[model samples]
Target: MVARRRRGAADADQYKPEAHSSDGAVVYVRVQEDGEFVITDDDGQPYDETELRVLRKYAGEGMRDMLQQACDRLNADLSALATVHCDTLSPRDKPAFQSRAFPEPEPQRNPLLQPTLWSRIWPPARRRLEEQNERRAEQYTRAFSEWEEAARAFNEQERQRREQETELVLTNLDAMANILEEHLGEIPWPRETSVSFDLGDDASTIAIDIELPEEDAFPDVEYTLAAKQPKVSVKKIAATRRRMLYRDYAHGVAMRVLGEIYHRLPTVQVALISAYVPTLDTGTGQPTENYLYSVLVTKSQWREINFKALANIEPPATLERFELRRKMTKTGVFKAIEPFDVEALANEVGI
Candidate 1:
């Protein structure tokens, strides 16, 4: 076996990129412009990184080929070592290692002395051997643990890099799609250019249609920005996430002021949703019995809509008592909602 390995080493020293892991595993990767080879040694050990010096006087092969050769040589070396050490080892007089599992030692012992002598020494010998073996095993275990942790961290870094790449690709795709849509709009649809929008209830689609009078209008129309601007983002995740641990959605605080009113408001559609309610979902646990409502609207654009004369939008579902505040005063208050809010009120009134 040793002779065979010697031949293998002679054959391997011919190649370039060569490195070995701590466990003696050889590694071969593409050779960089520099003689250094980049590799991972079992875990995150940077021993295999680029710019590593090659001690051997390599000759007669390309960098890649040489590195591969080195790996083969390393593996061969390790195999030889493994063979000589604790494995199906070569003949050695391991006096302390006398065991039925292994062949008899070279210097034969007296069969009678083996019994009495073994009986006397075996107990202490066995204890010492066991302790040594356990320590060795522990050392081996720690080595593997360190290797595993390093490898896991390395793999995670690679994963994050991949995700970033994927995100970049997706963003580029969206940009390209927008460009294409704008170009397509210039082709002129069979129908005239037109536009319509409607917001409806749950399970309802917001229908939007744009009409073009002629193909020429398509070139004049800036559709790309308009198309991309309408995107709605939705996020779905596990409800049991850490941040949601203390969450509680208030189910009932029934109340409704059918005709709440803010007189001559700036045409900005506003709803006075006053209620004595349980605290906000998470940590804030105050009851609404003592909170004021009338907050300004944000996150949406609406024309100057006076709450006065704006029709009260009764929820399609039942309202809890806490949400029900003083009834909106002024019967005229039922007519001042913004166009969109009016549309909503129309639906509510119809319901």
Candidate 2:
């Protein structure tokens, strides 16, 4: 029977004509002009059945491991779309500062206090004890003064840092953008993605634009091992199922962005977020971007969502609760639409 070659085993001499016997013996079978099968090695000698069986067993095991790894990778990519969470920030609490403690000097004992009565009564010993005690006291005072100066300087520096952090959380637009970038950058996306942020004249409103991955970026096939042979079967993903996955991934990204903004920027009242993909314009025949969806999420409505139950929530259904603009077909295919203008939309909606 004909069998496919194992993946990554590219040595032509090793797998000339792929075949395996009923008892799991690895044999290279060639067809003659008379339609008869001949099992032979690279030098055309008859293959030893004992060696063939051993090779077949190990090849089967390797194929099973490879198949398992491929399945796990696909599952991880799919799960990444639905799992997004972040720690929230609070501006009311003061940043914690670690203060340095004062260093205490060890107590010194007078060497003149010997067990002998003469040594204790000696006048020179008494004078030496006094001098030693005075020097120890002076050294301790100097150390204490230095420690006080250092503590004051450290406290002042920490105070300025805390003030800067509080200001950024309250009203600094540039600082807010930087912080947002850092938070968003930390997300482990399945594909390459880029994002940009804009702050409106009103400090509480913000806009976000995301460059989504193209449709071709997703995996379009699944791998499985053959039941009887050490071979892999690659099956194409159905068109409808792929479309649904794309829609879910896109919506999931949108939901994650909204969640991060509300959690990280405590003062943001409204967010205008849009996602788009790079494409060639039909009319101009030039490279351009197509906006897939745009949404306006308000902080008040977002608060009602149960963040703890995010795993059970479907991203596309969750987005239906907001003011959204999208042109998706019944089969989950998206069409281009114009993105929202941050200030104008806010003023029109009285948000």
lDDT, each prediction: 0.27, 0.63
Task: Compute the lDDT of residue 306 as modeled in candidate 2.
Answer: 77
**TM-scores of the candidates in the order shown:** 0.17, 0.60
What TM-score would you give candidate 1 relative to the actual structure?
A: 0.17
After superposition on all CA atoms, how large is the RMSD of candidate 1? 32.0
Model 2 lDDT tens row, 240-284? 877777787788777777776776666778888889999898999
Candidate 2 global Cα RMSD: 17.0
Q: Which stretches of candidate 1 lie over 4 Å from their true place?
A: 1-120, 169-351
